[model samples]
Target: MSEAVKEAVAEPALVAIMEQLPKTEVPARSPLAHHTEVLSRPTHENPGVRLWENALRTHLALRGDAGSADFARGVEAATGLALPERLQCHQSGEWALSWVAPDEWLLTGPGDQALAMEMSLREELDGHYAVINLSGGQTMLRLSGPKARLVLMKSCPYDVHDRHFPVGKVVTTVLAKSQATIRRVGEEDWELVVRRSFADYVWRWLVDASQEYRLSLGHPE
Candidate 1:
């Protein structure tokens, strides 16, 4: 399906985004930087998972009594993408459909387009349902490299072997001190998505665990 961005923003819109960016960035020497750098940390220590202090995108958590015909129809009409069929995802152009549960899903996109997306979703569904705009409640970490999968195996119980988790895999599972939606972005990269409150705790935990592997590549130049 297809949806359009409303493109409604005042001059100060960019200023707000700038103010929210995390003070620290992975330096040139860090593995995550342009060179042989590593991932950087936010200014503070988070709790459950790694959190980007300034959320660069928007997220919506939706819950509907989807067993009903009306709820399903409304949702399908609202987003070009169909609701995931039994924990599966459907993508139509710019949108993605992620199965959060039997009754819920997370609709996500650029921050500026959130309002338009919400309006479209609200128009389609009724009955005991909820759509909370979570633009500021979480963050993203795009993890990659030859050793990214190994790092995840050490952090969580979910199996990380290629035989078990192939490309296009997404699962919400546990990490040390927190839980996250670990997705395989590519053959070498993975994303360790964490919540806003738990960003610090997860960062520290990752660093400590990675130390044994000589993960000094992430240190600042």
Candidate 2:
């Protein structure tokens, strides 16, 4: 092999494939459709609605140099997904991209694609970058309906008005006692990005706050 080729091959890969730990099987409980609160439960007072709860899909942190054009393009080329511009989302049919930060974005796709998508990103990306499948580190919940805005306003401070937050806006804003990357999926459908550790707090806060509105919590699974 040429010296240049040897040098290239000698360097270790930039992103590591974080091992896939065995999935936890949450015990099934009584079906309470009204307790839309399951999404936030911490697994004792109420139970966490695991991956089996919803048909929706999600991927975790994609970290890279935000200033690298090649990194941005690599993501687009890798997943047929593009990084959202600023605090907005890019949706084509069912899939959407939400900017989580200057160097990261969240990919929402089918549940089955969660792992495969991360692999594709790993293979497609070049240079120094990282794509760790953090699906386990956080949970995504859908709080949507005619009253979704009113319900969200109870905790979030972002201007949820259609004029300020159009249908495609995404933001990292304060949520209850924690923080969230909130995105608008539709007029009535909103997505919340919350840490797994704080799931209980988020669920209880939402349930108590939305009780006055008769909000319905659901997974539609």
Assess the local accuracy of residue 195 in candidate 1 as a C-alpha lDDT between 0 and 100: 82
Which whole-number lDDT from 0 to 100 does residue 102 have in model 1? 83
CA deviation > 4 Å runs, candidate 2: 1-10, 14-56
In candidate 2, which residue pairs clash? 36-217, 40-203
lDDT of 1 by residue, 14-48 (tens): 21122222346832121122322234433222222
What is candidate 2's TM-score against the reference? Answer: 0.76
Task: Estimate the TM-score for candidate 1.
Answer: 0.66
lDDT agreement with native, every candidate: 0.62, 0.69
- Give TM per candidate: 0.66, 0.76
Question: Where is model 1 more than 4 Å wrong at Cα?
Answer: 1-54, 207-221
Q: After superposition, how far is residue 41 of candidate 2 from its true place, in Å?
A: 16
